[model samples]
Every structure is written in structure tokens, then in C-alpha cells.
Target: MVNGVLSPKETIWGLFSATFYTNVRANLYLTGSSSCLFLKSDHDDTYLADKEGTDYRYEKWFKNYSAIEASGMRCVKILDTYELTYSTRPDARVKGINMLRLPELYYIITEYYLSLENQDEAVKYFDKVLQSRGLTGYADRQGATLTLEKVIQERRKELICEGQYFFTQKRYNQSIYEPKSGKLYPASNDIYVFPLPENETEYRY
Candidate 1:
């Protein structure tokens, strides 16, 4: 197992990896809490939908840390391991946040090869990521076939909660997949580009 790649028990695993190095100043800084988004009740329709539709590897990244409520709904905890740990002990030194990880590099290389129409080299790096994530049978089951769509889905599954998915979609100009609506939001500048602030535009006009 990679030391701090995806283990929920590791303080610095999710959204960042410790396999490369540690973030010594993490404890001192206030990391934003994503509890509003991730800490969901079992009764929540969105949570249930996600649990049913998301990849098994994505489900493995979370844990239920809260007690069952009177309504029989349990809290489906996700990505709070490090936040809970660091918040409790502000004085503790922890690993620094790693913006990029090796798996991401592997995905990048995979995409690069794919762009060149080199399916073999693309599969080579893509399989490396799958193997690391304990999905050794995935590539084999697909007969080692690779496509740009497959690569995009793999990146979505692997890089969830890391703020990379939007950029990936933008880079490819792909339509956004809305899970709740079960529809594709068409790719366009209206969705992709941010509007200039009113204050900034006023002076230029």
C-alpha cells in the first residue's frame, strides 16, 4: 500500500498524499471544513443516489464516524479525518498539503499518450493507477482497450474532492454530468467562463 495515498486512517491522505512528502504547517492553518457537503444523513436522497452510483473506490475513501440518529439515519462521513485530527490539536505539526500527486502524474502521462494515439503507452500508465487503487482486474477485463472517454471517467473517479474535475472537463470542453438530473449540461462559455465583476467592468466602459 502506498503510505498515504488513499488510506482514510492517515491524517494527510485525502485531497493530498504523504507518499511524496509531509505538510509540516497543516495543523497551524485553518483548513476549510467540507462537512456541509460530505457529512450527509443516510436519509438524504442525494447521498443515497451517490452511494448507489459512485465507484466502489470512491465509496472506500469515506467512513461513517457519527452515531445513528433517532430517525435511524446514520451520518455518512467523508473527508473529515484530517480536519478532525488537525482541529483538535492546533499545535501539532503535520504534513504539508500536496497539490499534485503521483497518481495524477500517471493520469497526465496517460492522457498525453492517448492524445498521440498510443493506446499501449496510455494503458500502461492508466493500469498503473488502477493497480495502485487495488483494481488490478479493471484493465484486464476491458481487454486493455483505452479511449478518451475512459480516461476522463478514470480521472473523475480518482480525483474526486480534489478540485480537479472542473478543469478536466474544461480542458476537454466536455459536457458536465449532473448526477441528480441524470443529464448532461452542454459545454459552453456560459457555464465555463466567469463573468467579469461589475466593479472591474464599470471603469473600462
Candidate 2:
């Protein structure tokens, strides 16, 4: 769950639950682990740097490619294991699953600013997310400058195979182009959007 305007001592906890035929597992991965990250505007001097290998920093961050690897693992573990499983209950699933967490909200906000050509604000928010997650190299993938395409591409990479990608695809009305076969399947028609269920229209419960 996301806490609004995280304080220096506050925390954001993520709950992931997967149910099987005879088994269920609920995992909790709190952002920053035991550390309390204070979000700051200056990129270089944040709580992470201040508490390196201590409250706000993890020793694993010292590895050359640990951030990327850890992000990949978290993405797979949370989205794949939990989201793809039985998360269909009303209150149970509602408390268990949150598709739009803080980082996601930040990403959406960044996307909005990027659409408005507000590069400064977009970069600020996007960097906030990256810094919060202790992820590097993403902000400077192409160069010093950030672009809408880069943001889209990074988001796609982060959320691939999750439930969000399909909706994003629909929002952009993205074409399903087959590179190997050189075929483009358009998604502008009714094929992409599902029709309303007959039960809902036919009767009111």
C-alpha cells in the first residue's frame, strides 16, 4: 500500500498473495526494507546516500548490476506470481492486490507531464520513482535527456506480461506488428475492446 507524501519515518508496504488449489502464499516486500528513505530534490544527496549500507541503503546496491537484477526479480515475483493467481475475491483481493501503487502513480504522472512537453516536471517525478526504488541507468538510457518514447519503453520493460500492458496497449490503440512475418494487426476496431456482458445488460441484480 502507498502512503501519501511519505515522511522520513514512514514506510510503504506491498502485499502479494497467490492462491493455489490447496495452498496460498502471501508475500510482503516493503520498499526500502528496514530503511527509511527521505525523498529529496537533489539527486546526489538523498537519504540513500546519507545512510549508505545503513538505514536507507542496502549493501547489495554496491554490486555493479544489482539494481537491475533486483528490479527484474521484484517485477517477476510480484506481478507474475500474485497478479496471475486467484485475486478475484471482493475484500480479500481488494486488500491483497493494488495495481496502482505509488511508483506506478508516479510513472503515470510522469507520462502526463511528458505528454504536455513539460520535461522538467516529468524528469523530476520519474527520477523520484527511480530513486525511491534505487534503480539507476534507466534515467540515462539514451543520453542525459529524457524522452516520452524512453519513458514508454522503460514502463513497458518494467510492466511486461503484467495486467497493465494490455490496457496501455488499448489506450494507445497500439498495432500488433509481427516483425518476423512483417504483418501489422490493427487494434483500432471493436476487436481490442470487449463487448459488455449480456447478463449485466439483460438483468439488474
Candidate 3:
């Protein structure tokens, strides 16, 4: 979004990056807690910052990392606790799209998934959930059919400037046990949600 444009993008994705990036600074060791953040800028292209300095933020701005790679291991462990076995649907694998930059596409799908109170959206959410897609994966198939739309946007509060706003909106709602506070933030209400802006720093040599 532009500096003065405080509105959400009407589209279904939020892909463009920002000049100002933010990072979290922890005050103490894990009691499962953290504090104030240190913000900087991509005014160039800098690595994104994290919330509380925990790796969980990785799952927010990133679609690929150890957390996702290990999600299956954790799920399997939980499944085992039930003394239950599991099976992958024949459609369990999907073609990986490692390069796509449409964030709204991801935001909408994740929204629909979290909003579903029933399994009605389960098939749509994870018919073949274990695919390594980047961006286009979420929007490649538009049809009478439905699917899981990987959950990434809302999970990325710690990922500001890493590209999260419109795509996340109110979806992928990762509750804040403690509000995410920062030094370089706008008003509280303003920070809670967002409006999409355009990428201003265009190619210049």
C-alpha cells in the first residue's frame, strides 16, 4: 500500500513487498513470551524480521522452511497418540509451484478454510495437502471445485513488509496472547489490520 493509502486491496492477493520491514526482540527466555521489536527497512531488500525472535514467524512469512517440512512429523505423532493409522488420498500429491507472488489468492483460500465450521471445506483445504507450492499453487485452479489454499498470510504478523496485508486480512488468524507491540507502528487500530499499497521503489539504476 502507498504511504497515505490506508485501505485494503480489493483484489484476492497481496504480493508486493514494502520498504519498511520489522523484527521482534525478545526480553527473556521462553515462558512462551516476548517483547518490543526492532524495525528497519528494506528501503533495499533486507531479510524480514521475526516476532519474539521465535522460529514460528517463519511459518508466517514463508511457505517453505523446517516448520512446514516437519509439520507432517508432528501430525503423525498426534495421529499415533490416537492409536490410529493414516492414509494419503490418491490425490495426496500436487504439482509444486515454487514461484508465484499473488498474496491475495492465498489469503482468500485460507480465509475460506478457517471459516469452515464443517468438513465441507476439508476436501478443498487438503485433498492433496502435501504439495510444495510457492504462490501460483493457490490460484492455479479456479473451478466449480475447491481446495485448502495453504494457510500463510494472517500467520505472518511478524512478517510485516515481508508481504502480508491483503492476503491475510482476517483470515489465518493467529491469536495474539499478547498484542504484537512495536516501536515504529502506526495507531493501534491502524496496525491491527491493513490496506494494500503499491511497490513504490521501482527499477532505478
Best by lDDT: 1
At residue 119, candidate 2 shows an lDDT of: 79
Model 1, residue 98: C-alpha shift (Å): 3.4
Full candidate order by lDDT, most accurate first: 1, 2, 3
> Best TM-score goes to which candidate?
1
Query: lDDT tens string, model 1, 19-128?
Result: 22222212111223222232222223332321222344544644443322112221212233344355441333333343566777787898899889988788888877
Q: Assess the local accuracy of residue 165 in candidate 1 as a C-alpha lDDT between 0 and 100.
A: 78
lDDT (Cα, tens digit) per residue for candidate 3, span 1-205: 2121111432223332222111111211112334432232221122232111223223333221144212111111001111122433133222111122334344445456656743345334432221222222322444423323334522333224333343444343433322234233333445466554555435443
Please report, in order, the local distance difference test score of every candidate based on alpha carbons: 0.52, 0.45, 0.29
Expressed as tens digits, the lDDT of each residue in 60-134 for candidate 2 is: 211121342132122122222333344453343332334545656777888899889887788888876555545
Off by over 4 Å in 3: 1-103, 120-123, 126-130, 133-160, 166-187, 190-205
Report backbone clashes per prediction. 6, 0, 15
Better of 1 and 2 by TM-score: 1
Which residue runs does candidate 1 get wrong by more than 4 Å? 1-35, 38-56, 64-96, 137-139, 177-185, 196-205
TM agreement with the true structure for every prediction: 0.56, 0.46, 0.25
